[model samples]
Target: MSDATKLLAEKRTEFGKGAARKIRRAGNIPAVMYGHGTAPVHISLPGHDTFQALKHTNALLTIVIDGDEQLALAKDVQRDPIKPVIEHVDLVVVRKGEKVTVDVSVHLEGEAAPETLVTLDHNTLQLEALATNIPDNVVVSVEGLQAGTQILAGAVQLPEGSTLVTDPEALVVNVTQAISEEALEAELAEAEAEAGIEHEVAGEEAGEAAAGEAAAEGEPAEGASESSES
Candidate 1:
C-alpha cells in the first residue's frame, strides 16, 4: 500500500445546486464524506488536486478539513459528460488496518500459443485488502497457454495480504483456437442468408428501376412511329 495522497478541503457551509455551482466557479469541487457511523460531512476540495488524486484506482486520500485529518477512499465520482471536470465526489472514511473490499483491475501479460485467441472473461477482480494497502492491479500471464485452457479466479496470484472476494470458480481468462478465414466467411454468409429479406427487397427495387428505364426508352420510339402514322 502506498501512502495516502494528501488533500486540503474546506467545510461547505451552504447547500443546494447554487452553492455547488459557486464552489465550482471558485475552482473547487463539492464532495461528501461518510462512513464508519459518522455523520456525513460536506466539503469542497481543490479541483486540480482532487482530479489528479483520483487517477489511481482505489486511491486512498488523507483529507485535511478544519486542521483535522481523516483517511478516506474515493467511492464515487461524478463528472461533466463533455468536459473533463469533476462535478462531485463521494468519499468513504476508512481506518488504518481495516480491510476493505474493492474491485481491482486485471491486466494480461504475455501471449498465448500461436493461432489461439485469449479472451478475458473478467476484467476486474473483487478483493479484500487493507484500506491503505490496496494494489492498483493484478497481472495474469498467459504465456504458452494452449487452446481450451481456462484460468479461474482462484488460480490468479494476488498481491500479498490481498484475498479474493469473488467466486473462486469464476472464469477469468479463456484461451481458444482462432477461427479460420473460411469459417469466418461461412458464418458471415449464413448470417446474411438469415437476414436476406432486406437485401432481396433492395435487389428487387434496383431491378425494377432498370426495367422501368428500359421501358421508358422504348416508349419514345413507339410514340415516334404512332405520330408518323397519324
Candidate 2:
C-alpha cells in the first residue's frame, strides 16, 4: 500500500438528505467508519482532500477525528450520476498488521504471439495483505505467448507477505487465435441463422433497390422508341 493520506473529519450530529446536502454545500462529504467490532462513527470529511485521497479503491487513509487518528480503507463511495459529487462513503478501520482482502489490478506488460488475441480473463486479482503493505497492481508478462496459452491465478507471483484470495484455478489471461473481419461476420451470420434471425436490408441498400425498381417501371415499352422515330 502507498503511504496513507490524512483527512480531517468532523463528527456528524445531523442526519437525512437535507443535512447531507448541507454538508456538501459546505465543502464536505458525509462518511461512516466502522470495523473491528466497534460502533460505526458518522462524520464528514473534507471534500477536496477526501476526493484526491480516494482516487484508487485500495487507498489507505488516516482519518483524524477530534484529535484522534484511525487507519481506514474506503469500502464504498456513492457519487452523483450526473455531477462530480460524492454523496457518501463507507470506511472500514484497519490496524497496522491487519490483513485485508482487496482486488488489485492486473497489468499486461508485453505483446502476445502473432495472429493471436490476448484476453484478460480477470482484470483484477483478490489478495490478502497487510493493510499498510498492499500492492497497487500486479504485473504479468505475455511476451511471445502463443495461442491456447492460459495463465491461471496459481501461476501468478505475489508480492512478499501477500496471499492469494482468489481461487487457484481461476483463469487470469488467455491467448486465442485472432478472427478476421470476414470470419467474424460469417460466424455471426451462422449464429443468427441457427437462432432463426432474419436481417432486413440496410437503409441505403433498400433505398437503392427501390430507386432501381422505379427506373425499370418508367422505361418505355418495347418498340415504343422505334415507333416514335418512324
Candidate 3:
C-alpha cells in the first residue's frame, strides 16, 4: 500500500440535496464517514485533494477533522455522469492492524509461447490484507507458456501477509493454440449455413429496383400508344 494521504475536512451540519449542492458549489464534496460501530459523520472534503487522493485504488487516507486525525479508506465515490466532478464520497473507518478485503487488478507480464494465444480468465483477485498494506496490483507471468497451459488463482504468488479470498481453483490465465485464418473463415461460413440466414445485398436491391422501374415505364408507354391509335 502507498502512504496515507493527508486531507483536511470540515464537519457538515447540513443535510439533503440542497445542502449537498451548496457544499459542492463551494468547491467541496459531501462525504460520509462510518464504520467501527460509530455514528456516521457527515463532512465536506476539498474537491481537488479528494480527487487526487482517490486516484489510487484502496487509498488509505488520514482525514483531519477539527484537529483530530482519523485513518480511513475510500470505499465508494460518486461522480457526475457527464462532468469530471466528484459528487459524494464514502469513507470506511479502519485501524492499523485490521484486515480488509479488496480487489486487486491482475497485470500480465512477459510473453507466451510462439503460435499460442493467451487469454485472461480473471482480471482481478479478491484478497485480504492489512488496511495499510493493500497491494496496488498482482503480476502474473506467461513466460513461454505453451498451449493447454492454465494458471489457477492458487498458483499466484501474493505479497507477504496477503491472503487470497477468491477460490483457489479459479482459472486466471489460459494459453491456447491460435486458429489459422482459413479455418476461422470456414467455421464462420459453416455457422452461417447452419443458421439458414441470408443478408441483403445493397447492390442487388438497387438493381432490382431499377429493373422494376423500367418494366413499369414500358407498360405506361404501350397504353399511351394504344389510346392514341384508338
The candidate that wins on lDDT is 1
Candidate 1 stretches greater than 4 Å from native? 190-230
- Give the residue spans of candidate 2 off by over 4 A: 185-230
Predicted candidate 2, C-alpha RMSD: 4.3
Find the number of clashing residue pairs for candidate 3: 0
State how far residue 146 of model 1 sits from its true place (Å).
0.8
* Cα error, candidate 3, residue 126 (Å): 1.0
- Model 2 has an lDDT value of 0.92
Tell me how many clashing residue pairs each candidate has.
0, 2, 0
lDDT string, candidate 1, 115-189, tens digits = 999999999999999998999999999999999999999999999999999999999999999999999988988
lDDT of the candidates, in the order given: 0.93, 0.92, 0.92
Residue 72, model 1: lDDT of 99
TM-score of each: 0.83, 0.82, 0.83
Q: What is the total number of backbone clashes in candidate 2? A: 2
lDDT of 3 by residue, 128-181 (tens): 999999999999999999999999999999989899999999999999999989
**RMSD (Å) per prediction:** 5.7, 4.3, 6.4
